[model samples]
Target: MTTASLRALLSHLIDYAGLFPPAAVDLPTAIKNYQRDRATGDAWMLGAFVLPISRARDVPATLADTAASLPLSLLVGPDDLPPPDLQVVSVEAKTNDPAVVRQLVERWQPAMVFIELNPADEREVMWATLRELGAGAKIRTGGVTADAFPAPETVVNFIVRAADWRVPFKATAGLHHPIRAVHRLTYDIHSPQGVMHGFLNVFLAAAFAWHGMSPDNVERVLAEEDVANFQFTDAGVSWHCQTLTTEAIRAARREFCRSYGSCSFDEPRADLRALGLLR
Candidate 1:
């Protein structure tokens, strides 16, 4: 891709990154120069693609038939078809009593699977289930808010271990915002359970798990006056390892927190608010 096109795509990253809630511009906005953008040869552009949620049974087939140029995955619910290219998963949804998840994975054999982590069982049961599913299967694990909340450290640990097992992973949901600690003294009194913070709270949790860093060390990092310290390199950013400028890295840290930050979809502007990009 031309530098200009790359700049445009990266601009979208910043624009989306700044919003409290991650907003979807038209798919075209994500890919105006499809071929060039794809060829830009930047780490940020490497795994970048659209993730669509589908309800129809034929969604996978339809995606395979159309949108061949773009890589897409389905957030499945009652859609019965061989896992085409991408599949969304959670521990309970896949490994539940009937083993529907196992059946699907073995059958469709999608390119990747996003596994949601459950905190209730300390995530051991969930990881054991995936191990039982076999190592040859290409799968990635992720966590959702309902399964845990704020951050799912257990799920993050599973993802790291899964990597050691040759399983690659990525995350979604409850992660649409940037890093920051939240402590509304009033919220504690009103909620009585605990205070709910932003997605950054959870992202740091995952970073801590991935690095095998002590929770105490993580707390120290979190407690630091600067949130930028939490942005470290990962497999996703390995390609452009040399060129990752300080500003770019800082921007990435901010975007990571923003994209995964705390927000809800009761309104379309949730992501916008979390990023402080919207009024």
Candidate 2:
């Protein structure tokens, strides 16, 4: 595929999470930004607005008045569920216990549920449980502290596990840029700094895995830091000698990797433009 086609493969790949940390704007401000972005020419690159389930009622009347309903992805507590009118597309819950997830499924009957796994726990049972229930996975790629970033091996294992189970997943936190780089963890003036995983790295790794690339090679792709190491064409994207076809990327995106949650849409757009990936 050509570069243009490759870009198209990533359409609606980012779920706006502006209400969360770092870009934690108030509900009205976040709604205003989402409304503005949805009106832009690049709106195809945007996905659902993410918010806590408890705040579903606070969605402003202005957004409700719009002709098109806003899609939402809610982060729900074990006991919480969104109101029926919110048009929630998916629900996310953080629980290592399979029992809690089962209860959530039984109660809410969400169209999609993303289970955030506990890194310290052995996830085979949980993954199997989720698979049986037809739920998806979610990984926290980074946080405010340097210690929050999981090792490359851990993320690689996650990709492999999800693929092995035939489950799709999405990532959240600390993936504001298109490429891997050292950056401050937050908007705080004295924020801690760490090497964050790049969105390109994660999605490309997922695509490569989908195409049957070895796990070791996928980890290498995830750890790639030099921008020149990657080449994007209409046919697909290449990292050094390995290439994943645009068709494969589209498939992985739709069925395996899904979309990631991002707090700042503008930052990602600007970074992509700076890298000449976006016009």
Candidate 3:
């Protein structure tokens, strides 16, 4: 049975990205996987489908087999606005300056916008701008190479700062596992392996950060690779010395850390099941 804390922490946590690399599936395959996955008990953990804004028009013609309104988080670029026909809930794009974000949103706005930032170089000003614009932040946690993974310090900083700024955030890439450990980076048999960040670690750390935990403790939560380090009860979640109530987790999920994207929904779900977090 999933605990109340687990449900609060994990509800709608994964935004599916079957169209992206390593799992670079076709539109029909992605749609089919999404539909099939939603039919299972695990659907509670599912979120939006990630697609390029340019492909917004194709969603309709290809979605004839499925039910209506597949929520989409468009991977956007260069003045691209989603067409009126699609259910474009949010858009994700890279930007260092808030002015660029403001200008883009002024042209056409989605319900949510996540702007990726270089937390190291961009100071508090960047996050302040996001807060002012009523938008969220985005972080790229990993890629195909070992170097693609940012140091743990970078991720922790992003989480804490986003919390401090009262900005919601989402993560993409390299967070397909439930725990942080050395894993193959790609689907190919001989794929290069690296220590990837776990989605649980990242999101739970965000929850604590949102609740005003110290940065050192937040990093501790992120760095923990042992499943034993975490204890989820019906009332709260315990990580070492700190614990957050289910209500705290729900508030964080609603306001601070929204969701993350993964190329395979099944992999994360299966990992959660193996850990006995799901039944």
lDDT computed for candidate 3:
0.88
34 Cα displacement, candidate 2 (Å): 0.6
**Which candidate should be chosen as best, given TM-score against the real structure?**
3
Q: Model 2: per-residue lDDT, tens digit, 147-233?
A: 888999999999988888888998999888878889999988898889999998988888888778899998998999887788888
lDDT measured at residue 229 in model 1 versus the true structure, 0 to 100: 42
| TM-score for each model | 0.46, 0.94, 0.96
Residues 1-279, candidate 3: write the lDDT tens digits: 899999998999999999998799988889889988889898999999998876666655547435236888888875775566567788888988778888756655756889988767657777788898888899999988899899999999889888888999999999999989999999889998999999999999999999999999999889999987899999999998899999999999999999999989999988989999888
Estimate, for each residue in 39-92, the C-alpha lDDT of model 1 and write its tens digit: 543324233343334322333553444344544343433345534343332111
Number of the top candidate by lDDT? 3
- Model 1: weakest 10-residue lDDT segment is 12-21
lDDT at position 18, candidate 2: 87
Estimate the Cα RMSD of every predicted model relative to the unseen true structure: 9.9, 2.0, 1.5
**1 versus 2: better lDDT goes to:** 2
Error of 1 at 256 (Å): 17
Q: lDDT (CA) for every model shown?
A: 0.35, 0.84, 0.88
Error of 1 at 114 (Å): 2.1
